[model samples]
Target: MGYVSQAESSFPAQVGKDFEEFIALSSVHCDGWGISTNDRQHAHAVLEKKVEAAAESATFQKVIADNAADGALLHLRWATKGLSISENNTHPFVYGDYSFIHNGSIFPPDSFSDFIDEKFKKLIVGDTDSERYFYLMMTQIEKLGLAEGIKTTLAIIKEHGKTTSLNFMLMNKESFVVGSEHNSEKKPDWAPADYYVIKYKKDADGVLFASSGWNQPGWHTLENHHAAIVNRSTFEIDVINL
Candidate 1:
């Protein structure tokens, strides 16, 4: 989940309400929880990572209640089969001014091996495929600009890897981006058809982007194979069909 306010302000109360509801889904996505607040001047970020269920942690609840920022990212993790649940494997991975969180699994975690820039490869702190995916995106964003970097990363994944979903939320000082890319045929048979769908709601103050499953009345669904790049300062959004 992510939010970008028009000015420096706290998130809407409804966002907090929706998050409480979202946390209930942790029965399945119970591996970990992570969140971060980015600086407005492209400075640094304040982040927290934990290997525990958000629903069960008082600290998580307090942090969510006290969090205030112009831009933020929160991630709930569901450990892929062989991946271990640990603090190091948590989401909202940070590098420089960027923060990222992914919600999918790709086989052979190092699928992007040679493609990943060595500078980023050395930054890998966990054994999950999600961390690797984050670095890959960073590498592209470093090579191309923002939008193109994201698009190119998804292209690389689709062309070479076997993935269940590529749904993710990434934020930096200037913007917040959400990507929804999932193979319906590859989703967990036990999960609902709309499990990978991502949605967002825009209002006078700012915009809120989140995953589906919880009740999100009147929220606009971001299409699969697409990404929404939202400018933090103006709240202007550019939807790219990838």
Candidate 2:
């Protein structure tokens, strides 16, 4: 889940309330959970992670209940095959000013190595493909800026990977960016048609985005292969095609 409220720093109480309900879905995504909150640009995010089911962690509930942020991203991991359920492999992977979480699989776990910058690759501590995917974007961002970097990375993965879903949220202190892409035909056999769907709701408070699993009747469905970025200070959204 990703949230960007009106510019300034104020924690909307509804996020915590809604997330409490979201945690129940951990029955399916039961490996681990992580969260990152940013109040504004240049400040360190309030990042927390646990290698346990979200519903079982008191710290998870307390962290959500206490921390305040203008922008925040949350993840409940259903560990990809061959990955370990450890803190090192948890979501909301942080690198400098950016926090990232991805929901998908990229074939050939090392497929992104050739694309990552040497320095970024050195920073990787986890063995999950998601962490490598993050570095791939960071490497591209160094040359193409945020949107283009994300676009290029997804394009490359689409061309080379047998992707299940590349849906993800990448946020820094100044912007929250979401990438939505997936092979509808490759949806999990036990999941619903909308299991890979991503949706959002914008109101007087701000915009809230999440993967489709629970009830989100009025939320707008973010189209597949599209990326949306929310400016942390202005709350302006830039919708781009990937």
Candidate 3:
């Protein structure tokens, strides 16, 4: 599982300043770190690298803090099978104006590629199931809108593959979506408490969504198969069951 933070209007400065604190909290799921901060228009810049090296960079921390973005997404990865540890395999995969990060593993990962549309197959730069899932998401978004696309994508994955978790954060410049999904009836040994839970809450700044490790004061766990839809401009959050 990975950790993600999506912010609107305010940057979670603590995420950058207290990098070690986050590392300690999310150490259970660790591999790479990736972030994409969006500008007023929703355009974003991405930076991702293996954690050991990224955590040591003063530049990385500075970029995280200095970005006065309206919306931002950050991910700390835990490698699944078959993928090598490299920047390409990092989270927060971006295409066009959309950015995505996930915290679940699609079992029998090889089957993921078969679901991708031919147009998106070429966009895949990494071997992680998360990236393939991202492409499938893009295809869904084209057919259904964002929120429904996310729901449909998860449903299709659950129908075709066995996934330990299907949690993800998908965002562009204007809006963002999140989900907390898992095979709760037959939870896998590797699926820790944190993997099945997603927490979020509204603060003075805006809404913050994260995995179990973040020390959020009023955060509430998103129910299984449930999702949170956030409007970046107004900061209104609506919770829906998928």
Candidate 4:
């Protein structure tokens, strides 16, 4: 999912500009890169092994810390579904201005294929249920607000979860949402075991919400079944119930 303001530049421009600055300032090393911008021109391709190697090198860390973004979503994928190693199979699936990524799977894709419209089912260019689920949520969100759309989307996934699990992340430039559901038949350990932590930093302008703790302190976790909305201008973090 990706979006771009008319006044702002293209998705790739924002990523390269912001990322280069981030590297310069933070000195962090990134293994892989994935981004979803405002226009849905999702780019999840792997950086060349050499690029990843360079990013992980000590010299690269100094480059990331300097950059800042009004809105950004980053993903480090450890593929759990889909076998294709190409960029299309990677994270940060983009559509319009929305970008999406998931950490879990929806099994027996054939069984739930009908729940998604034929048009969207056709838009599915990848084999992973993660991308399908992202499109499903996007279709719903276009019809409903983010929170309500997520709720309705979860209902559909729950209906299909008689055989699978849904643990995923959805983000636009302004808000970030995540949800998890498991099958009763499967043991807890067998279900998705990933956990997420969200932290907030209040600056004079507004707040910043990060996935993990930053060096400065004051980070928080987004509870299960909850969504966090960060106002782009105010930087206020609003927690919405799923």
Q: What is the C-alpha RMSD of each candidate to the true structure, in Å?
A: 1.5, 1.8, 3.4, 7.3
lDDT against the true structure, each candidate? 0.85, 0.83, 0.70, 0.50
Question: Which pairs clash (backbone N, Cα, C closer than 3 Å) in model 1?
Answer: none
Predicted model with the maximum lDDT: 1
Alpha-carbon deviation at 186 in model 3, angstroms: 6.7
After superposition, candidate 4 runs with Cα above 4 Å error: 1-32, 37-68, 109-111, 162-168, 173-202, 205-217
Q: Order of candidates by TM-score, top first?
A: 1, 2, 3, 4
- Global Cα lDDT for candidate 4: 0.50
Over all chains combined, what TM-score does candidate 2 have?
0.94
Per residue, candidate 4 scores C-alpha lDDT tens digits across 89-134 of 6666766556676644556554456667666777787676677778
Cα deviation at 226, candidate 2, in Å, is 0.5
Candidate 2 has its poorest 10 consecutive residues by lDDT at 8-17
Tens digit of lDDT per residue, candidate 1, span 1-242? 88888666544453756656788888788888998888585588789878889889888888877877788888889899998889989998998778998988887787776678999999888898888899999999989988898889888877778899899888888888999888888878898888889999999988998888898888999999999999887889999987
- Per-residue error for 42 in candidate 3, Å, reads 4.5
Pairs of residues clashing in candidate 3: none
TM-score of each: 0.95, 0.94, 0.84, 0.63
Q: What tens digits encode model 2's per-residue C-alpha lDDT throughout 1-242?
A: 88887654323364544555677889888899998887675557678999888889888888777767778888999988888889988999888778999998888777768888999989989898899899999999998998889988888777776789899999887888888888878888988888888998777778788998876767798899898898776778889998
Q: Would you give me the overall lDDT of model 3?
A: 0.70
Worst 10 residues of 3 by lDDT: 1-10
